[model samples]
Target: MNYQLNINWPDFIKNYWQKRPLLIKQGFTNFIDPISANDLAGLAMEDEVDSRLVSFQNGSWNVTHGPFDSYDQLAKTGWSLLVQAVNHWHYPSTALIAPFRVLSDWRIDDLMVSYSVPAGGVGPHIDQYDVFIIQGLGRRHWRVGEKIALKQHCPHPDLLQVEPFAAIIDKQLEPGDILYIPPGFPHEGYSIETSLNYSVGFRSPTSRELFSSFADYLIANDLGNYHYSDPDIATRDNPAMILPTELTEIQHIMQQLLAQPHIFNHWFGTFISQSRHELDIAPPEPSYTVEQVIQLLCQGNTLYKLNGLRTLNVADQYFVNGEQLISPKLNITAINILCEKQEIHADMLGNALNDKDFMQLVTKLINDGYWYFND
Candidate 1:
């Protein structure tokens, strides 16, 4: 399903995005659920899927991690089962993410689907990332509080929650309604009845995380090799005291490493292009040769990019799943089509199919489980 989002992008970006909370009623008009609750539960049973069960009962909060074998012991009410990165494994669920492409793809995280029984909730909590929660199938009452400093505690070792806050926007959300909450906002939702909710979250990396990753990259690539040298030795008042001039020089040396655009950009492109979740990759049992792929395309076969595969372009360079493709012979148009579109065909490739280097690259990607023929 191709889901259509109804919201003003410019106005929302200016007034609401990361600034406040909003309840966009009928954000997806007549929105049909892309994946069923049964399917979500099934995904939770998979070893690679990240999932959890959260319940509130007996005046206490409880949390359980999955690959759950059975739901037989679960409470009829006051429990919710959540599966993260459903988009990676479920093809239909990826449609839920396509509409949000108005935002940058790198910043978009994954689709988390939760099925809740009556009175089910995880308690009031504050998140550091922005999220859009879309109500599906059944009704759920949601409450969002203003973004303010709040004390946090955990009833369960795995669960972190915030103190209850005064509700600023409180309402029952029906199917297709969306609640957009930015970072630092305290929010809670409980199922009025059996319900399903799809949350599309965005990634917001902290400076510490970025620096840590960059530092690791620098070390791995043998960068920042320059050593500090003070040729002009002026005797200080105390030999133990490091001069301010020496400190400034040391900082400049560190800054110079980041100033190299080529190295920095390549590292960032490779780093950010990686998916945070495990992908459902099934490479062909018998991989097709370059000539075989060309013949298939020529025979009107369509190629679809693997769902949740990250293919990104950084300054004319293309990176897929954290690996850069070396293709000096490939044209920008071909690269753009490969990076931008989910569906690729002979018409889209055009004369690029005739390019030997480009054909070999495509064949490599296809065999590596990044892309596959629709057949």
Candidate 2:
């Protein structure tokens, strides 16, 4: 996955990312598809895969759980199958997500593949995350509009669609063409033929959502339990009214939670490394003893890399799989390579393995199916 970085990455991100939409023709010259339509359908059939089929008929929306055996039963039009978290399950699709890694991994989400029949689309809807919609096979007509009054919109139970907007850019995208739509943009696509679209979405959590998730994490982890307290406070004269002192105490608790650098980093890192849902991991059929696992690593017969996992290293800590590995002795250079780069050479694991605890940690990861070895 070699990218020329043709567009100035930083400037484009600062100026247009999440602000507007753009189409880059020939985004990847001579690009080969990582997964075929059949392969995608096969994945959808898996019980653990997050898949859905959405269709519209008689001016009403209908959606069903997928693992669809065939598409023949449908109206043949006005329907789409969406499969989320393709990257976690398919190694081939990783290339589709490579370009977006230039931005922070936390900002980038997963690759969602949608297969649409002729004239199929979800509708004119806005997304909360930035997305790159890549046309794979056939062609699709895309129309995008600046965010405007959504009141004119008529809602369907399954889809959040608006009345058609004056398209700022209306174009038919062929294979290899890309449509990049930022958050808040209203866009719709219609397939001229049976089409496959890969939506590479970036993460954009709202403040409210983040706060809620963080609060949940705090409670789950049994951290930051200080309650609002005002020993010298007086009750409000108005029976129904809350006291200003209580508000101040609540604000103080929030400030205190945010002020602790260690706690904040730990929580944030765990939240980031944690998978949105349990990934489909095929653990070793016959588990090995800890000594056997260590021997495999020592023998250089097996290679281990994190599975469906991304890690962040801030300060002296490295975070992965919702846990922090605080290692001042571990080489920052080595750790960075492990986090960002998918493949790591056998020699790189040498120093880390010298420590028995570290080797055990690696073994546990492999045993838990968070890491896999190449034998």
Candidate 3:
């Protein structure tokens, strides 16, 4: 189920990607919903799924976390149900994200779907990441304000909303329209009737987050082991005061850790390749033998990477689900092919299948639940 997304990539990237908001009519022509409202509600009931219910009544906003037992408490209107990372659990919905692969795969977050009844909304707010909100089953009226600084306040402990903003673009969205909103732009949407909106969110890691992850990496690898030692002893009247030279030396030591490209790249590759949400991974019940896997491929069975599993490469080094693939003793090109594509066939493996080391690695990946065969 490959969806057709009509857009001029070069033009959109140049003019509107992060610069402003753009409403693309018929972005997904004759769009058919991959999941229904009832199915979405079913997902919310699962203990592992991250979901929330937001409702506004009597001029107050309320929010509750889910694994909810019932929706009987929900108000007739002015309420919405949101479930995160639908693509990881629903196979049909994964196709909706395939068309957006024109952008970097590592930057993608997940597919969040929300269902709203008449007059339902989450209120005006700003996000720190870019998102593409596609209208699904019914109509929704949306208002998008320009990217600007605005004061935000939390109505509910879990929800933060912005003050009123002047809309730059306001319109009614039908089944196939898309609303692209960049970071820091204020926007709000409400249902004209019962509707579903699929939001494809992208990640933008902040400096604080990067530094924190790097610090953890440093600790894990026992890096930054250098101890400061000044051979020269200086006598100053104020010995308690920390000298500027000592401060500079401390900063220099920290910078040295970041200057090592090998260390930094390994940490980043492993870090970014990790999925933020849980993946639907099921190892084969009986396990697979190398010979059996080879026979299946020869019989024209295709190998499909698990949905929401991140497989990426940094030069010849490849990573999947936070662990680096052992490649020094294996065929590098074959590893690249596996990392580069979502699916592969026997011919795609070429001579790699003949190499025992490569086959051993592939067998481990399959057994570990990172990759599987399509039945």
What are the TM-scores, per candidate, against the unseen true structure?
0.97, 0.88, 0.95
Candidate number with the higher lDDT (1 or 2):
1
In the range 1-375, model 2's lDDT, one tens digit per residue, is 553324567777787786778888877666566777888888888888889888877887778886677766888788888899888888768778777788877777788998899988888887777898888888999999987776435455556777778899899998888888987888889999999999888777678867887898889989987866667878667888777777878888898887888878777777777667447566675765667766775676655454457677755578886778654355555566667777655576657656656556556666767677765
**Candidate 1 at residue 1, lDDT?**
91
Candidate 1 lDDT tens digits, 285-336: 7998999999999999989888888888887678999999887576778888
For candidate 3, the lDDT comes to 0.90
Against the true structure, whose lDDT is highest?
1
**Candidate 3's error at 360, in angstroms?**
1.5
Question: Per-residue alpha-carbon lDDT of model 3 for 131-158, expressed as tens digits?
Answer: 9999999999999998889999999899
- For each candidate, the alpha-carbon lDDT, in order, equals 0.91, 0.76, 0.90
TM-score, model 2 to reference: 0.88
